[model samples]
Every structure is written in structure tokens, then in C-alpha cells.
Target chain A: TTPLTFREAPEYLTDEKKTPFDAVAKYNNFYEFGTGKGDPAKYAHEMSVDPWSVEVDGECARPGRYALEDLLKPHDYEERIYRLRCVEAWSMVIPWVGVPLATVLSRLEPNSRAKYVYFETLHDPKQMRGQRSLFSTIDWPYREGLRMDEAMNELSFLAIGLYGETLPNQNGAPIRLVVPWKYGFKSIKSIVRIRFLEEQPKTTWELLAPSEYGFYANVNPEVDHPRWSQKRERRLPSGVLRPNWMETRMFNGYKEQVAHLYKGMDLAKFY
Target chain B: MAKVIVFCVALMPLIWLVTDVVLGRIGPDPGQEITERLGIAAFQLLLVTLLITPLKKMTGWPGWLRHRRMLGLFAFFYAVLHVLAFLQLILGWGDLWATFTRRPYIALGAVAFLLMIPLALTSTKAMMKRMGRRWKPVHRLIYLSAIFAWLHFLWQARSDVTEMVVYGLLLLALLFIRAYWFGVSSLVPLRKSRA
Candidate 1:
């Protein structure tokens, strides 16, 4: 494989304080590996990303299985530093290396029938120890979706690497989606398939609880998850004495860029 | 000597946590890590404290009776740290009153800790003497606190409740053993475990 040519990150899109790469890899909610914060780092090494192929199907005009390298071959890779707020009220500003989802969507040539893009993660319990655990309520082969406009947004990213290095197994290598405006869970990890759908797709968290986790799952300070408040987020690399919270912003502070996509729609209802 | 060993064992989680922070190790979200560690330590200690009475009842372990108060107090100590970890690390020591009012789980957790305060104070020989016959009734608040602590844990378990169910089952077994002792077999007017 060719070494990735790193692009200079745009100033406006990145965070100045880079969370240590070790922190990014160690703390995760990837249930395929495990549910604990450290579980993915411990067990995700079993994940096989090299031989990966993504199935792009459904309403797209060009639908077929594309090897990971061939699918991403034509696109330019850019690093984005964006805030990732978990529904659990924790957040991180990650420097992700990948191109916009729009670039991939355009290449696939989605027909007028495509209203949503549904993503699926790897489901093999033999490799993913967490998938084998009957303890998890979430149905396996994690799924997520984005509206057509949201998928095409400038802020929507599909991350392949981090901190100028190929992604670690725990951080969703060799490729994953990174939607900055939505909660981290919406950016599905270790994605294996992408399907264009006419109706809103059933996502993992929403299936677990429709009231608590909606399909949109956008980061909104005002819209409290029925379980807890999303008004404040504890930034990673928290200082020992003073672990202060940063006020969570609507659409994770990408409001100007992506808020128009939800025009005239009740965000709280869609939340 | 065994009490001192138990004290050190009780203190280990906090020691591990402090050292991890000093070594810059407690992972990416230290706040969440510390918060959960302390909360779990407190919850586990509460479970162990509750277990003492049953062990004494079942195995007739004299040592279980001797160390019950210390174990209960240590449980109280961890509860304090658990409460402070939330207020300090997560809340940044801001508006605790708001925390009690706004977040019901925090309030549940707070109530559990509040229940511990009087129990700790009364566990002392002087206070036990001061309260006399009323002391036993007051310390029974442990049962209520344990329920609150478990609920506090279960409420935050948004996605999975496997651990919560385990903890809940443990508490239920403990309570069932007590109820069985008083109501069924041991009607022979046994002496109180705590002298």
C-alpha cells in the first residue's frame, strides 16, 4: 500500500489542543470490541481491516462491492480536527484523516430515489469478542444513517487515519465515518456496508430505545437525552483538580455549516 | 491486624486512581474514569458491608461480627469520595444544590450518602452509648441507602444493565437472608451480632 499523502488541515475546521492519540484509541464505545471504555483498545486488535470490502447497494445507480483501497483511491485525504461528543456527556476533539462523504456518495452515483445513506459495521462474533457477549442490549452489526443532505454536508467526514498515522484497530481502522455535527455513535465504526434507502433506516441505538436515542442523534445542548442532559460535555485530557465542562453546542458547533439541512424541522422532535 | 489489612485493601482503589492520575494513565476521559471508579468502589464496599451480617448468621464467623462497624464506616468513606468525585471532577464543584434538584440519580446518590452520615456518626462507641436503644433503628437506614445506591447505578445504565442486575441480585439475596433468619429458622432469640 502507498503511504498516505497528508494534507494541511484547514484552520477553521480543527482544534488547537490535540488530544493525545493514545487517549483517542483507548477510550471508545465500539461495542464490537467491548462496551467498557478500555475494551476496544484491549480486544480490537483481532479486527481484520486489510482484506475489507464495502458493499454499496440500494437506490444508488452504481451499486457494487468495492475493495477498501479502490473505493477511496480517487479521493483526496484531508485531516479534520472536530469535537466528538458522546451521548454519555463526554467529548473529544479528534484529528481525523479522511475525505468528505460527499466525494464517495458522488462517485457511487446515487439515483433520485436515494433519500438516506445507511451504514453497517462488521458482525463476526468470533473476531469481535464484544459481539459474543449476550449482555449488550444493542442488536449486533451496528447500524447508522444520515439524511441525503446531511451525508453531502461539508462537515460530514469518512475517517481512515488519525494524527498522520494509519488508524489503530480500536479507532475504527482501516476506515470509518466521522460526522462532526452528530454524536460520536452516529459516526459508525469499522463500517462494512453503505446502502442508499428511500425511508429512514433503523439504527442500533434507536432500536435499543426510540425515546432515548433518535435516528438523527445530532449534538444539541438543549435537547436532553431522556436519560441525561446533553447541555455540557467534559473534554478529554481532563485536568486532575479542575475537570471543567465545555457547553455543548447545537450540531456540535457546526451550526452555521449544517443547521440549514434541518430547516423548518423540529430538532427536538428529530433529536 | 486484620482490621488494618482491611483498611489498606479498602483504600487501594483510591490509591490506584491517584497514582494513575499522577502517572498520566487513567485513560482519555479521566473525569469519567475517576467518577466511575469511585462510584463502583463505594457500591462494592456497600455490598461487602451488607454481606458481613449474613456471613455471621450463616457461618457463625465471629470475625465478621467484630469488623462489621469498620467495614460499614469504610463503606461510608468511599461513599464520600464517590459523591465528591461527581461534585468535584464532573460538576467542577458548581451548584451542588442544582445537581440534587435537577438530576434525580445524583439526588438518589446524594440521599444514599446522606443516609450514611448518621450511621457513621452512630457507629462510634460514644454515639452508640448516647443513642442507646434507638441506635439499632437508626443504623437500619443502611438498607434504604443500599437501595438508593443501586438505583443510582441502574438509572445511569442507559444501554446495558448486566452489572446493575448482578448488583441488584446480590442486594436482594442479602436482604432475603436477613428476612429468612428473622422470620423462618432462627427464632431462638440469638444475640445481636454487634455487642
Candidate 2:
């Protein structure tokens, strides 16, 4: 693979202390590999990503399959340090190097009918034991979507590497979406397909439990999950005796950059 | 010697957990990991406490019943640790009252823990003798506590409930064995007269 040429974008960097690279690599929720926090790190190494491709189709003029390199070659990369807050009420600050999702979408030339963008993770039961397990209710090839404007938002990134290196297998190697404003699950991992759609796509979590997980899934402290409060999160690497607990911010502290996109829509209802 | 062995064995999980935390072997989220480990240990001990009477009945030996109080107390000990870990490590004691009121799972777990308090307090021989018949009725709350604990786990499950289902079935089997034995013992006089 050709080495990625990228520059750190000061405008995209967050002042918050970044989570240690080891912690970021070890703790993951990639259900494809497994549901356990450490499962991805333990099992992801077996799944291959050296030769990867993404199928981009639906409501786009330039609908076709593109090699991973070709899709990434045209655009320059930028390093953005963003805070990723999971719906489970845990968070981590990560330094990610990637190109903007808009740059890729615009280049694809989405048609007038396109109102939303849908994304899907690679579904291979042989490689991903979690997909083969009867225990998980998640229908394989995990799906996620964003409104067209939300997709075009500057904060919607498609990350390829993190912490100045290509992504670790467990941390969504090859490519993944990173929407800072939304919950970590909204940032789908190990993506294999992208589609522009007219109607909002039914996301994986929403499909499994609609009441608990909604399509928008914007990080909002006011809207509590059915079983737990979203008001606070345990920042990762928390000491057992001295835990690092912080009040969860609306839009995961990306409110200024992404709030205008929601405008008058009810986040509580959407969430 | 037997009681000492039982006591040390019952204390092993807590000892292991503390050692892991100290050694940095508890994983990335030690607070959450510790909280879950303690909660599961408490639940497992509760199941073991429930098993003692049935084992004594099956084997026609009184030895198993001797360890019941100690095991039950250990379950309560773990439950206390679990709740403290959640309160300090996870919640940081922030808006706790609101959390209890809003999250039914937390409320369910709290109810389970609360039910064990009376059992632990009344486990003393003097208190048991004073309470006499009342003691049995009060001790029956353990069944209710087990149910609440199971529900606490069930409600929090996301998508997959296989683990919760297995636990529920195990709890049901234990309860069924006790109820069946109760029915048989209570009918002993009628059966003897008929014979």
C-alpha cells in the first residue's frame, strides 16, 4: 500500500487531552468482531483489509465500485482530534487522519433525488465470528445513515488512520466514518458500501431496538436511554478509585459546529 | 477447619479482583470492569446461597446448611462493593437521586440490594431465636431479591439477552426445587396416614 501523505489541520484539532494510543486501540465496540470491549483487539487481526474496495451507488450519477486507494488518492488528508462519545456513556479523545466525507460525496456527484446518505459495514461471517453467532440480534452488515445536509457537514469525516499511523485493525482499519457530534455507533466502522438515498435509511441499532436507539442518535444529555442516563460519561482510562467523570455535552461538545444543521428539529424526538 | 476453608473460598473473587486492579490487569476501563465483575460475583453468590438448603435436602446431610449464612453474607458483601463501584467509579455520585428515579434498572438493582439487608441483619443466632417463626417469613424475601436482581440484568441487556435468559432459567430451577420440596414436606403427615 502507498504511504498516505497527510498534514495536521490545526482548525480540526481539539484542545482536550488525547486518550493514550494503547487504550484507544484496545477498548472497542465493533460488534462485527465481537460485542465484548476487548473482542475487536483480540480477534480483528485475522480479518484482512489489505485489498479493500467500496461500492458507491444509488441516487448518484457516478455510481460504481472504487478501489480503496483510488477513492482516497484524489483528496488530501488532515489530522483531526475529536472526542468520540458512545451511547453507552463512555468517551475517548482520538487524533484521526482522514479526508472529509463531503469531498468524497461531492466527487461522486450525488443526484437531485439524494436526500440522505446510507453506509454499511462489510458483512463476512467467516471472518467476523460475531456475525456468525446466534446470540446477536443485529442483522449483519451493520447500517447507518445521515441526512444529506448532515452528511455534507464539515465535521462528518471519513478516517483512514489515527495517531499518525494507519488505523489498527480493531479501530476500524482501512476506512471508517467519524461523526463527532453523534454517538460512536453512528460512526460506522470497516465500511464496505456507501449509497445516496431519497428516504432515510433504517440504521442497525434502530432496527434492532427502535425505542432505545434512533436514527439521528445525536449526543444529547437531556434525552436519556431507556435503561440509563446520558447526562454523564466515564472518560476512558478512568482510575478505579479516582474515576474521570464528566458531564456529557450536547452534540458531544461539537454543538457550535453541528447544531445549526439540526436548527428547529426536535433532537429528543429524533433521538 | 471446614468453615475456615469455606470462608477463604468464598472470599477468593474479591481478593482476585483487588489484586488485578492493583496490578493493572483489569483492562482499559477498570472502573466499569470492576463494577461489572463485582455485580456478577454478587449474583453468583446469591445463586450459591440458594443452592445450600437444596443440597442438604438431597444428600441428607446438615453440613451444607452450616455454610448458608456465611455465603449469604458474602453475597451481600459483594453487592455492597458493586453498588459502591457504580456510585463512585461510574456515577461519581453525580445526581444520584435523579438517576435512581429515572433508570428502572438501577432502581431494580437497588431493590435487590435493599432486600438482602434484613436477611444479613437477622443472620445472627440470637436474632434468629428471638424472631423464631417470623424469621422464616422474613428470610423468604431472598426469593424476591433474586427475582429483582434477574430483572435488573434483563432490563439492561441490549439486543442479545442470551446470558440473562440462561440466568433466569437457572434461578427458576432453583426456586422450583425449593417449592417442590416444600410441597412434599408439608404433605408428609397426610401421606403417612394414607399409607
Q: Per-residue lDDT for A105-186 in model 1, tens only?
A: 8999999999999999988998998878766777878999999999998888888888877788888888899998898889
Reference A-B contact fraction recovered by candidate 2: 0.64
Alpha-carbon error at A36 in model 1, in Å? 1.5
Per-residue lDDT of A159-200 in model 2, one digit per residue for the tens?
Answer: 999988889988888899999999999999999999999999
The alpha-carbon lDDT assigned to residue A22 of candidate 2 equals 89
Which ranges in model 2 have alpha carbons more than 4 Å from their true place?
Answer: A1-4, B184-195
lDDT of 2 by residue, B1-195 (tens): 999998999899999998998888887689888998899899999999989988998999998988999999999999999999998888888778888998888999999999999999999999989987667767878888999999998887775667788899999888888657685333221122211
The true-versus-predicted C-alpha distance at residue A200 of model 2, in Å, is 0.6
What do the candidate models score in CA lDDT, each in turn?
Answer: 0.83, 0.88
Which candidate wins on lDDT?
A: 2
Model 1 stretches with alpha carbons more than 4 Å out: A1-3, A9-15, B95-98, B130-133, B184-195
Q: How far is candidate 1 from the true structure (C-alpha RMSD, Å)?
A: 3.2
